[model samples]
Target: MNAQIALMLGQDGVTSGAIYALLAISIILVFSVTRILLVPQGEFVTFSALTMAAMQGGRPVRLGVLVLGLALAALVMDVVADRQRYRAWIWPKTSLALVAVGLVVVGLGLSVPFDRLGMLAQIAFTLATVVPLGPLIYRVFFQPIAAAPSLVLLMVAIAVHVALIGGGLLIFGPEGARTEPFSDAVIELGPAMIASQTLWVIGVSALLTIALGLFFEVSLWGKALRAAAFNRLGAELVGISPEFAGRTSMTLAALIGAVSGIVVAPITTIYYDSGFLISLKGFVGAIIGAMSSFSVAALGALLVGQTESFSTFWASTYKEIIVFTLLLPVLLWRSLRQGSVEDDE
Candidate 1:
């Protein structure tokens, strides 16, 4: 490789990794707080991107408007939905679980229209619809699962994933959809040239990550959320409602998903059924973070981005092959280390 090419690859790797890190962190947030491996996490990304693209006339828009709208909608909807759907079934365990799956299906169904709507309208509608799903899931499942095993929650998460995929296919058809990015600016800094769209992705991802980190680290509610994630009963002893933490975490995760969607839509076309791959890659990034550290997950995401970018440059046809080949070894090593740590504990 040429020296300049190598340098560019390195920079791109960091930027790509940062995006992945945001995704990974979102996954980790849900997993850590709810003790559930939320598979629908990836769909959130798709929903945000599709909605934003649709809202912006199939082009890019101001990051501030996109992020603010997504965050507000996600947070509000999460809170309301949880209280309405989940809080009502606080007694029946089996029924509550079913309700959670049903809601996932419903969310998936609602997200389908994004592919068809005008870009601006799509963003408005998606944000309006998805904001409340987080709260609904928390009220129905995570709250009741406060005393349940992680395995049970894991199964529920898987069910949600299946439901989302099935519903997406049924509603949106099998065709892939494409949307234009917001900008076409390219900047040259010495030997490296960065696409304006990619730069926007990087900048927006960085700002959101930092803001979220600060919110979780500094706010009183944020502290309670952390406590609940680590130990629900302990948080309860301190007069913090674990249910509140679960709801907040879900909303936050969804918000992150929406932001990810907005940032990513410019570069990649989205399809209704695309959630699986996106979620898988994001989950990989989260796993790389050991499912706890947000900062580390962010690092992993950038690495993934670099891997994808460079792999594409080398052999577009075999890009996936090259990426997976690299990912497998890393995953295996991480798994072994985790096993050893558990054994020691």
Candidate 2:
């Protein structure tokens, strides 16, 4: 290929890689803290994208109900847990607050109208509709079995994935949508022009990654998460709550997934099932990193992105096969190098 063609391809690859890197990090975060593979991570992406698209089109985004409903369920669970601790009134108070939030969201959705809102407000609404589901899902599905073995957690994650797929189908229907671009501006490179959204993808991904690093290195909550990830039992012994780690990790994962969705949606059509494939690509990168090393996983995801882009240019029909093929050697090499280890008694 000529130099200009190569530059274009590189740009596309880096843009796509930014999203994959975010997904890889989100997957790694959830897996590291909770030991669950978090296969349904993609659904969050799809849901968030569709939610934004719906809002942009002036449809009453019903996602507010989703967020509130899940919150209510978690509140109920909390109330159940707290009653035995002599805080029986916690349930009623939290339930009232949840009900108020749900009603406000519903009312605002009906009265304000999405098209009338500014872009910033629309983005805020989208975030409000997607981010809380993370902690709610964690509370409902995973918290009770927080101490379960990795195998059990993986099984449960698979179940959650299937459930979320169906939930996505119901929520979004079978149609696909591409939202309006965050910015239609273009930037001139040496030989090729790049969309501003590409910069958005790369810039936001880099910032979030750096922020996450700083969080772990500098913040109290980050230290708690790092401690839990390194040794759960030890973290617990030192008063780091496992539930807190699980909830926080899931929240961060959802945030990453939502942002990835919103950022990429304008570039391509997104449907209910789109998330699975996106998450799978990220998982391939995760596997390449042995699913634990953050830097390696990010690099692997960038490699996957570049491989997919170049492969598409060479043979569009075989692009996916070519991209997926890259995972085999990495898996084999890791398998051979590590062999197998027996669990300690």
Candidate 3:
């Protein structure tokens, strides 16, 4: 390949890699804080992308209905799980809050002219609609089984991933979509040109990464989450609530996933079921990190992105196989390094 082509491919790799890094970090955060592998994390990406595409196309966005329905289901779960606390005339504050947010989202989706809205408005609206699903899903699916074994949690995550795919099909239909670019500008370097959107992806990803690092290093709640990840029992004994940490981590995951979707949507077409493959790539990065170190996972994801990009150039038909094959050696090495243990469950 020529130098120009190689540079362009490298740019694509970095752009896609930034998004993968975000997903990897989100997966790591959720796994660390909650011990649940977030298989459906990619749904947030697809849903946000498709929703934005619909908005830009002047089509009505029906995501609010989902928000409302999931909110109601979560409320019911809350009541059923804690009958004594919710027996009074007043509803639980958390349930009421989510329901109210759902109603507001529904109202906005119905009342606003999304097509006429500015880019910022559409992005904000999209985030508002999709980000809440994370916490609601947590409350409905994972919260009840907080103490369950890892295998059970993984199975549940797989189920949720499947269900979300079906839900995506129902909500977004079977068609693929791409959104309008945030900008039409391009930058020319001696021999290569870069799309403005690629810069957007990389810039936003870096900012979010720095923000998260600061949050964990400087913020009290972030420290609490770290503490919980380090020692759940000790954190609870020290007055940190595991439930709060889980919900918070889920919220952050949703935000990261949604933003990733929004940023990358313009660069590629997204289908309802596309998230699984994207998230699976991110999972490879997470596994490379051994699911522990955030920096390692992000770096690994960048390598995955570069590998996938270059593989497509050389063996387009087998790019996926090439990307996935990376997991085998890493997994084998980890397995060999660790001692076997009995399952208490």
Best by lDDT: 3
Native-structure RMSD, model 2: 2.2
Candidates 2 and 3, the one with greater TM-score = 3
lDDT for model 3, on a 0 to 1 scale? 0.92
Q: Over the full model, what C-alpha lDDT does candidate 2 score relative to the true structure?
A: 0.85
**lDDT-sorted candidate list, best first:** 3, 2, 1
> Local distance difference test, per candidate?
0.67, 0.85, 0.92
Error in Å for residue 308 of model 2:
0.6
Give the Cα-based TM-score of candidate 1 against the true structure: 0.74
The better-scoring model by lDDT among 1 and 2 is 2
lDDT of 3 by residue, 1-345 (tens): 999999998988888888888999999999999999999999999999999999998888888998899899988877776776666554557867889989999998888889998899999999999999999889889998999998899999999999999989998899999999999999998989988999999999999999999999999999999999999999999999988999999999999999999999999999999999999999998989989989999999999999999999999999999999999998898888886756647
Clashes of each: 26, 0, 0
What's the CA error at residue 269 for candidate 2, in Å? Answer: 0.6
Model 2 C-alpha lDDT per residue in residues 233-315, reported as the tens digit of each score: 99999999898899899989999998888888889999988998999999988888888998999999999999999999999
Tens digits of per-residue lDDT, candidate 1, 107-197, equal 5443454445555655555554454556655555456565677778788777866765675555444555555765777889888887887
Q: Model 2 off-target regions past 4 Å?
A: 84-103, 343-345
Pairs that clash in candidate 3: none
Model 1: residues >4 Å from true position, as ranges?
Answer: 7-15, 53-125, 315-345
